[model samples]
Target: MTPAPPKNFHTSNPETETAIDRTIPDFPAAQLSDEDKYFTHHKPPSYLPDLEDEVKEFIEYHQRNTHKRIVLVTSGGTTVPLENNTVRFIDNFSAGTRGATSAEYFLENGYAVIFLHREFSLLPYSRHYSHTTNCFLDYMTEVNNKVEINPQFADEMLIVLRKYKQAKESNSLLSIPFTTVNQYLYTLKSVSQIMEIVEKKAIFFLAAAVSDFFLPQSRMPTHKIQSQESGGKLEVNLEPVPKFLSRLVDNWAPSALIVSFKLETDNSILIKKAKNALDRYQHQLVIGNLLQTRKKEVVFVTPSGENSWIKLTDDQISKEVEIESLIIPRVIEIHTQWIENK
Candidate 1:
């Protein structure tokens, strides 16, 4: 069942009482008055499926049952909408191709994937999650091959979609499709809450070119805006969008190996920028994404000074020419090794 959208803030919200005695107990403080109005007026959203208590335990069971580990994978790009109504948005160059292709690789490696993707042009693996308390996975040693086949490298994903068609008859995954920065924030917060509850070490990909800033002062317009973008510059107050790395490492999934991305404009300072990211988030690796080009980039800055500066440059102008082929393998190597270290 879809839950109601978060509540509107008021000075006298009874739920805010942080006293020792309460049912829900210690709910987060209300947002700034500005955020209060901005969020409440918007429609509430449903999330992708969560693991049943039984399913979560089953993941644990699979870990013990098979001795292989489960890792969470999140990808895709975020959106920043222009209006309270998300009809129009300022989009980024991220097409979720990197994230989707990487996810396919992870699935091919036989790891359970807890995908938290946004605007993924590609689809995810099946919904028939195995037994676990709030988890989804399937393990096979001499696994059978009836899982179907298609363009997707991850047969699991293909099977899952077709299965969803059979089970839900075209019901889509819980896509909290957000176009505004706030809308993305709202959805991301819920994702953080759930990830925090998860105990395993996960592999999170910050492939999404999350907007650095968002409308700070959003209010219910008495009338709808005729246009979202204008020729001239009209400034709007904005707040920082949430970054999952710091919070995820510090509080949410400390055990889960972390891999982050850094997008740089200047090539000379790319490593410096990546080092800053490593210091900022304390991640194991950072994929440096150069702006404005899709050619296989200077893939560097993994672990304490170790890196792959190999340039798989593009010549022909097809989609594959612009994307990273070894990106997935390099990530798989680092994560597999990281997990082995632990």
Candidate 2:
């Protein structure tokens, strides 16, 4: 049963207002493009220096293997904070299933993976255990004063564990966490720039469901919004998030194979939007999927105006075959051709 919310849960006492001024400031128009203005005004995440250092170290570790391929897999949904202190925020429905699953396949195919994902979202190897109906502890049993994997789950668990161990032993997988859209954009730019040394050997698998709108820092309230302040009404005005795919394709990781995802509820416009994104950003590929059938099928759109569908048969779906198992191999095939042509 759900407990009732506390009284005045959404309101604050009028007399208890803090000293921080809540005035909305006016600003003059700027000549800068929305993308330029966004990065210019919004401060980078405080942990960016450490993140850059970590990425650089990861890349340097793999630098000795000139034939190695690296894929940056962005995953999960980005949050749009409503206030500077962030008591409330907006989020999408993505659970990072596609990205996490694809990362595992990429690792299996011998490509180094940079898994940039939302905090607490599903990850590649551990995803098999998390976000499931069974509790993680349920997969274990105690016998003879020792904890052991339950025989029922041991077979599958062993396979995932072995793969996870191999990835760790080889240091082929790097995980980066981001929560807000701002952090994701900054981290993506920094990581892509660092990956520039690899040239055509890198792949940017942009699967993250980024927010299309955001509450700008300059406009965000300093404190949690109070219902009493507005007489039980609240209004929020969000600014359009600057599209950074062009910057990513043109400036950051220019020689890399950039594959972006296009998710739509309407199937009719899915291919159109996917193709448009490729033409606009000049990216290598776009994976289009319907919201309802994403797990069963996906359409690949390339700049050459060729489109193909990858789908799971009823038998495959019933047997729990993941579409990413097919998607990753096709992406690798395209990447191989792309590298040779370059």
Candidate 3:
């Protein structure tokens, strides 16, 4: 028998700013939202079908180029919504500082990034990245991939890539941003698709705090704390958190070098859980952390059962030095070794 969904499942609300209660609503929808509505092709999340054609052209265009590899990294936490058309919700305390900061490190180390960002995160979108395209084939190739990720992120990346391709101007690569969990999933799927055809071994940072649970439907009525009847009778039904990893590892990125994270309520149980994460997903690595902590001290667990811990004491060491300095390089180094072994 399946477990019931939580009462509180707050999803991303792009607008409608209000104080976050981290509380779930008290009602249940008999029917869930039609997942097909969100997708370009009527599926949950969405897919960019044009990305493959672009990657193929890009590979041929850069057949003799000296580029080592193209890396796609996703960072930031996901929000939990009480219902689909999210008004009141629950979300992680994460500000997306770690993921965004780490993205900068990846860019500095010379990896082209599909840096998926959430709103109000550390990294702001960079226009400089849009000015680096050198040719039609080159621009079209990468733009094609960028465009398919999600219109929100693709728009920015495409603008930068297109401008550079047409003007033959050199510019920095961009950090493609998205607003909500749905957008993140769509973009992640697109990047995974691009990496496969290009023969690129991607370094995915499942740093985003994806809500483990989702509400039954979006159009459910706004839950009222003060009910019309107070006689101790309420019926609320729920669904489980969407299984992102099952689809990502098993189907989308079967051979990619994947890194996952596990957040535990108990620190003592973490090591065991980290090891379990590695075994469960067959990922290259698994990072574990305790829930609700100021310091994001994490344990990096390898598939062979090796584990490493990084404690920052505080996320920001100096004015300019942030947590990403400690994290991104480790990811790059691990990714480097993983590719070499293959």
Candidate 4:
């Protein structure tokens, strides 16, 4: 005779339990909005505690110098995992060129930078050599059994290296990486809250290309889906990602100067959508750029209905001048004016 099952174990029939487990219930539409339910139901990332500690330390270090303004620059793209175990994922398109370049300029303008970026994306200083046709090895040479920067690239590399070292020595640049959308959201919220110590001196540059939709954790499969079991055709249902910009503005870092980027394929509706975001979020500025012309031009949209275009001249483009070089200075000007007005 077998020993009795534990008292805590369910005595329900196996078939009934299996049937109930297969049914995934939809969220109640009348009770709560998806956004509200998201935070309530979803669990925070496992690495959040470690991330918070690092951010707190970084912020505390800068707080010692009251005059130092800190900018939290988010870069690259977030991924939406298809499964709980994460065999496949949906990703946004961003090489982190804008955020990385903007960060260097922010540092040059005497701001401590907290770079919250997607894992493995291009980074400042190193970004100059990454994601290019040539490999990093192409810029290296082995002479007298010692490795050195190739002579052709040494001059440019030297300038970037000096700035990079300066930033490191001053302890002004803090880099934090996130991979999935969940991790990104958690990290952003935690970092922003910690930045409250700096109050009006903080700036949030939200340049990351975040996904508009994602599979909720409750509905995700525990293991990777087998193609054979599904008859070779796969269908996925995704829910709209919460609009957290409003939360960021109203709750997270209310006093911080917030700047968001809008990239669109259509020129006619770009300004309209940008203005909508500004009105909706009540943020300071929206930087709008077309997908095709983002490298050469961008429009600055403000909450007060002020719209201005920042474009690179033909000569500037030919000279390989990055548009962020111009974008950052204008942003700094606006930030200064905003701080003074407040």
- The C-alpha TM-scores of every prediction are 0.62, 0.89, 0.62, 0.89
- lDDT, model 1, position 317: 36
Question: With candidate 2 superimposed using the best TM-score fit, by how many Å does residue 171's alpha carbon deviate from the native?
Answer: 0.3
lDDT of 2 at 196: 85
By descending TM-score, how would the candidates be arranged? 2, 4, 1, 3
* Candidate 3 C-alpha lDDT tens digits along 1-342: 111211112323333122221221221233222321232221223223343344434433333353535555555666645545556565665666556556556656755555566655545234333223543234343354563343445576776456445322222233555555665666665556545543435566777777665544453456643345657664445455555565567655666677777877887898898787677767778878787652457778887666788866542544435555676679778887877887
Each prediction's whole-model lDDT (CA): 0.51, 0.86, 0.55, 0.85
Question: Which sections of candidate 3 miss by over 4 Å?
Answer: 1-68, 83-85, 124-172, 218-237, 291-296, 312-321
Best by lDDT: 2
Q: Lowest lDDT 10-mer window, candidate 4?
A: 1-10
lDDT of 2 by residue, 203-296 (tens): 9999999999999987988999998987888888998898899878876678999999999999889999998888888889999999999999
Candidate 4, residues 175-203, lDDT tens digits: the string is 99988888888778778878977888899
Model 2 residue 91 lDDT? Answer: 96
For model 1 the local lDDT of residue 283 reads 73
Off by over 4 Å in 2: 1-31
Error of 3 at 303 (Å): 1.3
Better of 2 and 4 by TM-score: 2
Model 3 TM-score relative to the real fold: 0.62
Model 1 ranges with Cα > 4 A deviation: 1-68, 124-201, 217-223, 226-233, 293-295, 313-325
- Measured with C-alpha atoms, the lDDT of residue 296 in candidate 2 is 96
lDDT, model 1:
0.51
Which candidate number would show the highest TM-score if scored against the true structure?
Answer: 2
